[model samples]
Target: IVHGAKRVPQDAVSDQCPEPDGFFADAEQCDKYYQCSDGHITEKLCPDGMVFNDYSTEYEKCDLPFNIDCSARSKLQSPQPSEHCPRKHGYFAHETHNVCDKFYFCVDGKYNMITCPDGLVYNENAGICSWPDEAKRNGCSSEEVFQFQCPKVDEAVAATHPRYADPEDCQYFYVCINGDTPRRNGCKLGQVFDDQSKKCDWARNVPECADWYKGRLTDVQLAELENPPTPRPRATKVSKRKHQRPRAGDDILV
Candidate 1:
């Protein structure tokens, strides 16, 4: 337990007697630590994500762990290790307790996963794990079954694609390899967009419309008919102001 005068780094109890209980600066800032009478401070650096819990008698650095095994626990009722947890959802309990030095946990699960996030691997030095984007999860892959193959696509195609394939064909339909829905769509100023698929019921969007015109059809064309705009109601006076002349009864004989 930490108490009285602070302990010195390297665990040399302060011969000077009692030290402060909480955060105190050090002659050497290699790392500021809570000193115990024992004076032993940790050599490993506390990582960015970690936090130190200061007890009246001691200070301890804690972090989550990696490399979890879900079945490691002996039974459901056994006391859990601080390293591992048994959350109810979102994650599985590695054990009643945790074993790793630094790892993430969730209220739902003892461990977010036995491993870690899908992309990031772990780095012992940095005390974190990361992965290369465009690794397995990134770049083009054959896993997806598009209606048509992208010969060589650019931004417009990316934005428009089979639904929008550049200015020339963004509104037109094409066939994707998967044969789900035809990769065809178009936007019009009004409803009943086109006779292409009898899909011309109405335009769902107006990318080039004015503020007032937006969400409204420009004209009353058959395929694009919209309800006429209603004017705002004007205010009406409930009563006229008092007459400037004296009251009729008072002025009768004046």
Candidate 2:
């Protein structure tokens, strides 16, 4: 029974003081618990991925036993001592999280994995992620799988020659004036970038060939195109043949 600001016992109305700070299990709910503080009781539930830590100083809170040290507590529901996580080879922590912009190497069971959200790779020396060009200036290798795919172009070239024809679209080309975002531009009608000549020409005159060629190929050049070499089969051991002397009669007949 409760009176104005104090809780009174059922048998005696005189017992009106509030309870001390402590954890108390709820009577009706198994997953819920009560925290008594300053004569007032408040109900709370542990957060997801964690369980109530009755032995903690703040007994109402929840935590992973292995992650917290509860040795000072006299009564612990389940105490778990911290142990070393085994060394993982080649496997990085961020890779498990499906993040490609940053990488991590485990050391002594713990690693701090950081990410470069600006389409850059993490530089170990600089302790931050930076543009590949800037990373190179700082003497750091800019080799990482970026979260986004951006064409690799030299800064000087990107600034001067920002427009280039896309091989797939003879009538359209891409412009990278900002060195980041690309814009598409269409060529004039009746003409397209000649992949063979590397210049605008009649699409009908351009021979059907790979776009990588810089200029039109002659008949001899077309015939000289090399094919990819086929993979060779693995060699197998051959039994040695026994040597025998040639027959004298057989040699004379030969």
Candidate 3:
């Protein structure tokens, strides 16, 4: 819907007006189409980053390439490149291979850089943020990002999705999916990962992690966080309206 008339590339396709009033797609180009009205023909181009959806001749619709199949008419207009945008529109990966979490979303040859959530990488193929293992981008695998490997276990234990303590940080842990792929996770503030119990618990209860917050928090601060004050209950308001009895001749309200 965001179209720039000045940016649309000019292309001529010598075609007859098939219908009196309708839109028709060009045979060779996915972004080129024709508008016919009263036996008159006009060549049209979709926005730079989109393709003409030729599912029907009744309506003119332009959509993103991800949502439309353009195999037969895969040819696209020449890109109007800009800073960080190879094309006028679409999701693009970071120029640096090692920088996996950031990407660029381009519109009208303008760029908006975006960063994936913690422990996630931008999936160029799917155009969204996803787990490093799932994204499968070279140099950005789960092993490379997390630097943790799932311990070898029997099939039975592997199926249970076991948790393991992070060797470097007591407040963080890793969950092995199918006992192979390691996913980084963290315990909430004031808590530490308990390897024996395989869950987050008070720092004081976990022997190895008892002094995990030694320099970070004081004794009183840890106690206050571990034992937070309970929330007060709200007072209920009683209705003051009295119910009235209907008389014999009164119309009943169903």
Top-TM-score structure, candidate number: 3
| 1-254 per-residue lDDT for model 1 (tens digits) | 12123323553544422453433323332222344333343223223222223222334433232322213221221222333443222222233132222244444234454454432333333435333211222221222212244444555544543332322332333432232222334444344233344233344333321232343434455233455467789989687776677666775553
Off-target runs (Cα >4 Å) in candidate 3 are 2-28, 36-41, 53-61, 233-254
Error of 2 at 142 (Å): 24
lDDT of 3 by residue, 38-140 (tens): 7667778887888888889998889777777788898989888899988888888999997999999998899999999888999976789999988999999
* Model 1 stretches with alpha carbons more than 4 Å out: 1-148, 151-228, 238-254
Cα error of candidate 3 at position 172, Å: 1.9
Q: What are the Cα lDDT values of the candidates? A: 0.33, 0.45, 0.86
lDDT of 2 by residue, 1-254 (tens): 11112333444522232356676544443234556666555556543223355554355555443343334432322222112222321113243333434755443344545566644555433445555545453322232332222367878776754555665666655555455544444645445665445466644465552332336544344344333356799999888998788886765444
- Which candidate comes out best when scored by lDDT? 3
- Our tally of clashes for model 2 stands at 4
**Model 3 steric clash pairs:** none
In candidate 2, position 82 carries an lDDT of 19
TM-score of 3: 0.75
- Write the number of the candidate with greater lDDT, choosing between 1 and 3: 3
- Model 2 misplacement above 4 A: 1-150, 195-199, 209-254
TM for every model, in the order presented, reads: 0.23, 0.22, 0.75
